[model samples]
Target: MGHGTENGVGRRAVLRGGLAASGALLVPATVAAPALALSGRPTATSGVQSGDVTATGGLVWVRSDRPARMVVETSATGSFRNARRWTGPLVGPDTDFTGVTRLHGLPPGEQIHYRVLLADPHDPRRTGEPVTGTFRTTPQSRRSGVRFVWSGDLAGQGWGINPDIGGYRIFDAMGALDPDFFLCSGDNIYADGPIAATQALPDGSAYRNVTTVEKSKVAETLAEFRGNFRYNLLDGNLRRFNAQVPSIIQWDDHEVRNNWYPGEVIAASDPRYTEKSVDVLATRARRAFSEYFPVSTLRPASDGRVNRVLRQGPLLDVFVLDMRTYRNANSPDDQAHDPQGILGREQLEWLKRELARSRAVWKVIAADMPIGLVVPDTTEGLPNIEAVAQGDPGAPLGRELQIAELLRFVKHRRITGTVWLTADVHHTSAQHYQPSRAAFTDFEPFWEFVSGPLNAGAFPASALDGTFGPERVFVKAPTASNVSPAEGYQFFGEVDIDGHSGDLTVRLREQDGSVLFTKVLRPGLVGQ
Candidate 1:
């Protein structure tokens, strides 16, 4: 998680007035449940729920306590008077006892209520306590806007459950924003370092926690990946949020192994990566990613791979990139001038084409790494490369490559209203990189913002320090000019686009939802 601008949920004005008025305008009544957590197991609630309804449809998720069939209901109320229903049996170890049913064929511009009914196998007369929640579909085109939560690096070292506290806070804050969806900017789990075996599925439970680093082995196996996911979802607050909002997710290093590059090993720099081995990891990661996330994967990668994009609506188009499965190791310090390719040639071509054809009011590239922070210069005056290497380098590499691409793409195509967003630096910062008369006078101005960890190991004091370092080198911007904070920590990225005036409002927030900073980027300012 890196800093783009110090900020919080400071866009309340925009949220209240103008095109941003889709602030839960349709969601009327709240459910009557006390939001209780089940005892003695991670399956706190009997079922699962997901929200942030869209124009077309939303999602409903649940997990059975035992082998069972469930009938999910979507209605305008608790009574099944006129509800939309989906019935299916929970199957396989693949879902880890959970089932996510995409509820389709709903009308737009209305608030919908939903719940799950565990059909009793024996009597068939008894139905388990119904779990209910509500969501508001996107308003008319002119009234719809886009908002999403972005953060990364949620692994912690010593504290048992302290790290997840920040993430819970983030969810509450995001609930206020009422975004159509939430995004996982990567590093969703810290299965790296020595604690590779600690991730697990607790006894008789649907969820688990990274109790000890000793057991959280880097997810090298399928079960390990599943357990890593279970550990994060086990948190009560996280579970509640996930049940309430359908999350659109993508993967970064920690999801597999930290700082992983294509066809290469990080430790020994060995080039012994096998297609079978790579596919094994990819398959496991995608399984866990798909099982736990609400995203719909329709256009699977052409090679029978897993890459896909979600077109939420005309307001936003999210292109979820698969940089890990294909990317080469970040360009080493020696090759900073000629960075090792981050986006493999094929993926790069696909991404450029996607951008070129997007017609949404806003195009959101859900990246899991910082795409603008100049790493080498940021670490220049620091302890040394050795010190910087102590943290993941994939983030800085991502930022570097994204910056290069954004500048070239916007200028070359005369594209307007493109925003770059990323997470993994563990702190918040925002930057508006525009072509300067003295710098690149012919290029268009673009903006990139970075958000820090939602929950993770405590960042070093040096990260917050204000000294010339390799990490600080990329702070050059429309505001900071040439100054970069030597260090900072714990933040997330948020952008509010006004459908009324075509203006984009961005913010970087701390754990408590305090706005550390803010910036406004106008579509008219591009190429200025």
Candidate 2:
């Protein structure tokens, strides 16, 4: 997969055919070859990705199999005539051989081409054939229009990359739309869900997974967690998608363990794990998460928090929330005086302040879990609640109190053009919250869109808690639980904000790129 193109265009340039193209987001290269044994050229098999992109800058990532110097070069076009060079880190064992470089001074709304080279530390001349990528910066003008795709829950419930089905075909479908970016709404990796080589499908076919050592079991150690991130790069479709789309990533429960929170210990009865402390595992997982994704705020030297506002020009400002990191333990969720609920106190305040300060046409809140979805905890059984809602319909209780407080604040501030997008439930649905129909009538009406499972098991839509009076306008879910990808029901959502008219359209699409549902909202409206 090294420099398959002659004139210096990326080998993946043929991805115009999208899913049909044989190009990979990452193709396995021989990264561990002896340094001085042969030609001594360093290799980067993990491909390349860019994320946390803004109008002026972005971050690029790559992994080397051996000790090598990371070097990045960028160009306005594919031609490397007047490229700018940036010397990156010396990627080695300390960070698991992965490195990220920040790219600055990029022009807004224009496609910037780049290439990554892994060079021998001693000699710059000894370098691997470059891996190339391209992405457009966020537009500075409101009239430029903006569009992005979102989904979550990858390789969960025992599903992994299936080479028989083109290895994450959903990415190819999404990449075809040419979204400005991708909002990966958490559950980016399933540290607790181990994948097998092959399994029989109910439809008389077999699900053949592209297996890797890291994806074989629950990740506990730091290396295993890093492997969990690298495991997804084995899929050519996903690798291609990463090369094309810059992602705004956040993590949910699956990245560390199923339904995990701080200070929680795995029950001893679950013998699959020896590491009982979820905190220890989470510390390791968080480092790996920071290393893997290119979040501007979560860089290695930074404070490493997921809650930040990404200003996408004048049209959109995405408030990425980390509901997993800072939260009270999952329980019956009925505490009447709980302020440190799902979002904790600090992140909740930050979100509220950011929402009030956003001057963009739309303020899209990206929540890892749905607000009103009744996501119950199956671990250790009983009445433990996993997400925001706790099934009580009467008054705001437990984590619902935090959400109610935020909604009330929004109402009092007269904040308009707000919408919520999430995807932890593995189904596609839309809800319109209205005060007139509500038990809690303090907040103004808004829309929440849920879509996902991207390449994982599909479950029935979770029961909606009536705390915010969210009416399910549309829902598409499987009747059975944990439906395999072979049986269909995989989904992703698209948001297209028209520049001239300022009408935001949301489309829920399936794995095959079929639009399942659509909702349109105006910019200056109190409600849709």
lDDT of 2 by residue, 1-528 (tens): 000000124422422222332423222322344556546477776778999999988999998878899999988777767999989999877777889999998889888888899999988888998888878899999887999999998988878887667768899899888888999999898888888877778878778776667777789898889888988877778878888888999889888888888999889898979999999999999999988889888886777798899999998999999998899998888889898999999999999899999899999999999998898886866568899888888789999999999999988998888899999888999999988888899998999999988988888878988889989999999998888887888999999999999899999999989999999999888866
Top candidate on TM-score is 2
Please give the distance, in angstroms, between residue 187's alpha carbon in candidate 1 and its true position after superposition.
1.5
User: Candidate 1's residue-wise lDDT over 1-528, tens digit each?
Assistant: 212111223221111111122222121211122113222211213236563245768666666554345667877654558877788554334465566667778877556667777654443445666665555566556455556677766653311232312323455666565655677777676544323322332243221122432223445666666666655554555655554555666667666554544553333332322223444565676676666555555212324333455665666677776656665544333233323355566776777888888876667776665443433322112221111122333322332444355447756886656776776655566655444411223445555577766655433222321111122313211222111111124466677777777566877776657777777766656542
For all predicted structures, in order, the TM-scores are 0.71, 0.94
Candidate 2 weakest lDDT stretch, 10 residues:
1-10
The Cα RMSD in angstroms, rounded to one decimal, for candidate 1 relative to the true structure is 10.7
- Model 1 residue 147 CA deviation in Å: 3.1
Q: After superposing candidate 1 on the true structure, give the runs of residues whose Cα lies further than 4 Å from its correct spot.
A: 1-54, 78-80, 120-127, 157-160, 163-167, 193-216, 266-279, 298-308, 331-340, 375-406, 437-442, 458-489
What's the true lDDT of residue 348 in model 2?
93
**What's the lDDT for residue 196 in model 1?**
30
